[model samples]
Target: MRDFPSRRRGWWARQTPRRRVFFLALGTLTVLIAVGVGAGVGVQRRKDNGPAYLVDPTTPSGPPPDAYPPNPSPNGTVWQPQANSTWQIVLGSPITIASTATSTVPDVDMFDIDLFGNSASTIATLHKLNKKVICYFSAGSYEPKRPDSGDFKKSDMGKELAGWPGEYWLDVRSSNVRDIMLKRLQLAQRKGCDGVDPDNMDGYANDNGLSLTSDDSIAFMTYLSSAATSLSLAIGLKNSLDIIPEVVNMTHFAVNEQCVQYNECKTYTPYLDADKPIFHIEYPSNSPQLSAGDVSNSCNTRVDPVSYGAGGGTGTLSTLLKKMNLDGWVQYCDGKSSTTPTES
Candidate 1:
């Protein structure tokens, strides 16, 4: 299994044969596979978990006074995933969210993607298909390879992201930072995304070296919310459990990484209670022990239990064990797997 990560690394290295295609795949946490174990499962909006968060903007008062896009949609307001909204997130690379992904799970809701990697036409394609698009960008950390990486001032950078080498903590407080982020939002708008998913906002919880405060994070989120609003796009507060109450109103949805694993799903309820969707992802405990029963959830399944086992895992994961490239490979919590690949 030691050779597995290296083997996967080779895949990306070879991907640049035509053009240097840097990839950012989610790291597999082999340790957590056993966590979910025999926990009984089913797709749910979390029943009466003590009145979830107030996420719905159109309260009994009838949609907040905030200005929204002029709706010309035949269906009225654009697509926003509610409790039962089916969704998928793949940041590893560009995905044909509209024609390809939508064509397959056209019935599902919401497709969160890397904002920088995807092109404007790609986003336009999704909008043409009448699908809600979520543009993803690293809010706290700055990847050195991004198109606008050079735009980030060295003074704005802090320390190397503890584990990620080419990345570093960003001073979310700087006006320069705001400018770069605003540019990203503008890109999202030009691309036609329905929303934005600014990741790594939980810098306050990490050794960001930026001395970032919860208030700072909140302020940054507020800025992002305002930017999204200007573009008529919804924005999500990505995995900052501590500030949920503070920033909940500013953002439209919540994109949680591992709520159950972190025992913080409750903190995310505020968004859910408000009728927003909590896009979740859990890792497989054992890379090699994938059972046929793992299909219960969209995540927490084995790659090839027979060859990999309960712990030994390999290959690029798609969506749900989808693929390293995040194609159509889906591994549900029940261990059921399928790769409905689109034409490359």
Candidate 2:
């Protein structure tokens, strides 16, 4: 989701040696807290006769096979992103991924962009540059502007997404919808995408006319997981916190928006515990040039380690400061900003 726009302020970079040391120390402290709290919670749950929620760290590598369909077929190696991997997302414009000797986007590890708009050659170019491409698509909603919009059954369409004209939520329970999403996944595979970022997943939380519930989300995510895994394409849950406990094992990572502003970063650390990344974005509605306070509030938002930390406090995050439109412009925690070259 795009964030509300903040007014432009005097933006500046914070690359001082002292600030670097502070961030380094904060990272170490967060790790310690996470470890200590994790053990304590595990023990307490056992003592309190509560459900054992923590998965055994040594159980196996990758997501649980049970989350996928039976007898799934694999195509090739799935690109898994680390929690610390830096990224840039340009959904509003199809930016140039492959750089010439004269120009290039910032040297980030991954580039997330519109799936339907991007060309296979663009994805191939990113791969040639040793970069991972996460294709973005609307899995839970129907956009009338899409090329395949006519394929959606009339009965499967629900209420329009508020503020987004011509976009409506899809009934996740429909097999027809699933079939369309599978085609989208196939397209992503053909385009050579490393992973898929399916958006508008939290339709149940909205005033969706479909009477959809969290269970529907879980079922849909499961089906998507099975399809993605079978195609050897990694899939991420986009901003659906309620389904994390039920579907985190199936998800490769998370695409989160404004968790710090909403005071919900703690809920998403399950990805970190599962050794997956949370690609986070925050739109400072107050100013494009965020003040020091804005930076600290966004970057240092305390993540609780009760379910997920070592010293008993906030966890570090990989965050981006961007505008509401989600254009090519991006700013890191270090305060540097740049615009990726977008196609007109």
Candidate 3:
């Protein structure tokens, strides 16, 4: 996850402001890796914790939690998180979550997407089909391409994001960072997302440079979840298996990637115990855009060939046989397929 965020930052940062805002807004679930983190490692600190908040998973927003956190969310969107829902996570470039195709991917649940990449009209399209929408965001780390990058203070940053060139780590402790995130959530409401997916929330799992502890991530998630709930926006946990037991109650679903490949799917089963969906993905085809052979072997549970392109091919299909961009094109176990790209 850290690698995905670290490497891709350069690709994102160098883009024009419009494109940068668009990509980061999409909340592409990139961990610190090659393409997204092109800049040096970035680490930032937290301050005074965060605003206090509260929500009833079964109830839409009403009031903010008393004490600690500030009043209302950044934008005052009221949302509630829930369960047994289905989902898809594709944050890479160009994945279209806002298509007008009346048809669905066929099966399971809801759709999670880049908050920026998806538009208000796209959300309306999904609602027409009775599906809930989850907006994605980076609750951790600093991406050079984000609209709020300039909002981050050098004093609040630390480390080189390693493989990423244009990016660096962010101090989660910064008041500036929290404020920016609050604004992003507000936009989710303006865009009409039912829930929110904040990626890279696990600072405890990487070379984050902030000397960030699991406790730090836990506190942060608690803060974010509570705030999201207050806005009536359902909230979820993205791939922080270590803290699931502690934060599960705060989240409505578990958004995960590569859980099958890492042999760690069991860690998220608790979400199932809680009757929540663990949105799982494995790069069976190296990239989502699988070569026929790659798709055949990987999908069949045959041997994993080293030559099989890893991340690139998986991006195209692993989620819905659509690319990392999450376009409407999708294929399933029965060899079914479809394509529908969203238009803003």
Please tell me which predicted candidate would have the highest TM-score against the true structure: 2
TM-score of each candidate structure, all chains considered together? 0.65, 0.74, 0.64
After superposition of all CA atoms, the RMSD between model 3 and the true structure is: 27.1
List per-candidate RMSD values in Å. Answer: 31.8, 30.1, 27.1
Q: How badly does each model clash, as a count of residue pairs? A: 32, 18, 89
Residue ranges of candidate 2 with Cα displaced over 4 Å = 1-75, 97-103, 304-315
In candidate 1, position 236 carries an lDDT of 83
Residue-by-residue lDDT tens digits, candidate 1, 241-288: 899989877777777655544555555555545555667665545433
List the candidate 1 regions with Cα displacement exceeding 4 Å.
1-79, 97-102, 105-107, 287-289, 292-328, 333-337, 340-344
lDDT (tens digit, per residue) of candidate 2 on 46-76: 5664235434455435345445443322446
What's the ranking of the predictions by TM-score, best on top? 2, 1, 3
Put down candidate 3 lDDT per residue, 1-344, tens digits, no spaces.
34675466766565899887777756655644544453322211112222222222333353445333434445566544344344555465434443556655553357777887767887777778787778887778777787777888887666766676756666676778777888887788778888888987776777877888888888888788766777678788888889988997788777766554565655654555555555555455545556676545434422122233232211112233344445454555445555444443
Q: For each candidate, what is the lDDT?
A: 0.65, 0.82, 0.63
